[model samples]
Target: MSISVHLDRITDPIVAQDERHAGSSVRQPELRVLMATRYGRLGASSRLRLLQYAEPLAEQGILSTARPFLSDNYVKALYEGRSRLPAVLAAYARAPALRAAVQEHDIVWIEKELLPFLPALFERALLGANKKFILDFDDAWFLRYGGEGEAGGRNRLVRTLLGGKFPTLLRRAALTIVANETLRDWALRAGAANVLLLPTVVDLDHYPPTAMPTNPVFTIGWIGTPVTAPYLARLAEPLRQLSAEAPLELLVIGAPDFTLPGVTCRHLPWSEATEAAMISQCDVGIMPLPDDAWARGKSGYKLIQYMAAGRPTIGSPVGANTTIVEDGVTGFLAGPAATWADRLRRLRDDPPRRQAMGSAARLRVAADYALQATAPRLAAAIRSIAAR
Candidate 1:
């Protein structure tokens, strides 16, 4: 019944203690980290945060080499079929490639949702001398399959398969990193001894604020992937009501299927560079989500992107969004369409408040969640686990 099924070297506190004590002031090793990812580039939040930690890790003599497990064809199949099995198998079968990549590194870091197949490969590599394994995830992948509330039907099946594979992988990892307190708690309950909380971070320098455009129309934008595209429907009524009075434009980047009546909708193809630029052009950014378990696992990266771009964000009060948006200060957290409509109207009418909130959001991200500020903590965590 334990969440962790087979983790080695976790039960021995003495080993962790010995590794820490012996390595005190020993000048940490020049670590080479191998990262296994589904996507090859730093496009998504998970990949971006891992990349953000790389520069700091390098400063500490840690070099990271990333090897993407799934190909574009495999990912296309996953989306086209709306199933993860084929993608999962392809990732698992990439163990030979993963093993080859790890030979060039000292440790292996598996990003979220990849544990199902890669764990066996990781275990095989760990048997070698001086090789380490680190597991990183932002969501409760195990609970996604069969956990209670809002998860049903087809989603239940996906969750069940994911949950089964995740624990098996976690049990074999040397250390585990989770994004928030909720996920950390879940990992600990699953018997992951060295679970650490490492939230998603933004590159503050890359997303510096530009002068607000003196446009004739007020724009509200949303940026996310096709997976999260459906939540835009929740805002259809609110956006329609807002557009009834003002020149409100709705710019949706990455959601090809998204459309709204009475509001100007611009769908941009999903590219990291262009998406960031498109998001920067908006007057206000919106993050709307249904209250659900899967949504709760989101690390508020959308809000972080908006904040880093110095855009005031309006988000549904769900999961980490509530924690990121300091309601009424940095941004507003509205529950219903009526409240969403009211906030949009207020921001539309008041330019100064929007400017002030945008400034505050930028400051918040730079201080707490920027890569420069957060990477040290991540490095220290790696150092801790690596020593063990």
Candidate 2:
């Protein structure tokens, strides 16, 4: 069943005119943006955000080109080669291609992960005209070197090499883009200037609400990658208990290894289209996150996706989840396994209420979070930086 809801037409002649005026007034600088990302794929959250800005920046005559530090081919080969020293060195040697690509762009945007090879890439990019560098980081990567709760200190080797590198890297950046106010504040405290708070956004056109299933099963769906797979495993027993009294199905997408007892588990392979289809089929989307430093830096893209698909999302009140979801209005925030069970049971019983909340969630995303609406703000920021 496909629900055909027309999104408000976002093409404003005035907006186009404003973009034209902005471009015409400012000398069309040969502003090329170099995005140095860990994963070079177009599908990742960071790459998507870069595309959102790039498309609009192009409209305003900014030439934005992304040079991903790591390519899928390299990663595939490295993993398939399995920890052989030669294979690892071959991967490390590919950093020069990224440095060469950096020469083509005027502004170098570094999505620096805590990887050893990145500093060399950073140093190489810094060689050319000391190009206007923009540092982008989401999570608390500095704290991630040591295992959580084992707080003596980070590994001596890692600490010696990377402990102080992030601060040094930030000191060199002309501008910075952070995921939220929390990150922005941290950057400021750390003495970084020109910090911009740009939260992760969705391609609303692609993620529109589909027709709702009429005889839909009361399915609690969770969609995430392999890294977050264990969180879904943690949900198994609570879902099992929930299924006892209620007609419940746990739809797990993207986690190929996830399995739950007594619950109808539908495990689908990970694909962009497949993930969207699976999400659209959900009655309620659940994002159960561990309340940790790493999870706090998450921009709540999963919740945004669920809400944009017109599915009421129940997520943990961590990081940007608190900002994205308005409890009982857009979706409920579950504190524990018991809360997760209660929220799932409540939504399962009340289909009409679920539909209403889903409708509200869609409206909320359209108003504030849609890429079409928010793209111009980002474009304006780029223009402002370029003008300087």
User: Which candidate number maximizes TM-score?
Assistant: 2
lDDT score of residue 177 within candidate 1: 74
Q: Mind sharing the TM-score for model 1?
A: 0.83
Please provide, for model 1 over 1-388, each residue's C-alpha lDDT reduced to its tens digit, 9 standing for 90 to 100.
2222111223334334533554366676677887766565534744674655677678767788877766566655543457666666776677566556767777788775444433344454443555567788766555545533355325645654443455555666677777666666667766665665666877777786786657868988788777677788898888888788877788888777778777688887777666667888888999998887777777878888888888899999988888889999998999989999999988899989999999999999888778877666556556666665
| Alpha-carbon deviation at 86 in model 2, angstroms | 7.3
TM, every model: 0.83, 0.85
Q: Give the C-alpha miss distance for residue 92 in model 2, angstroms.
A: 2.8
Each candidate's number of clashing pairs is 5, 2
The residue-by-residue lDDT of candidate 2 on 2-108, one tens digit each, is: 11111122133333344566636556555677766655552365565575567766775677776555556654454344444554455467765765676777777
**Runs off by more than 4 Å, candidate 1:** 1-27, 42-46, 76-93, 113-131, 147-162
Structure candidate 2, residue pairs in collision = 2-211, 3-211
Local distance difference test, each candidate? 0.71, 0.68
How much is 123 displaced in model 1, in angstroms?
Answer: 5.7
Native-vs-model 1 lDDT?
0.71
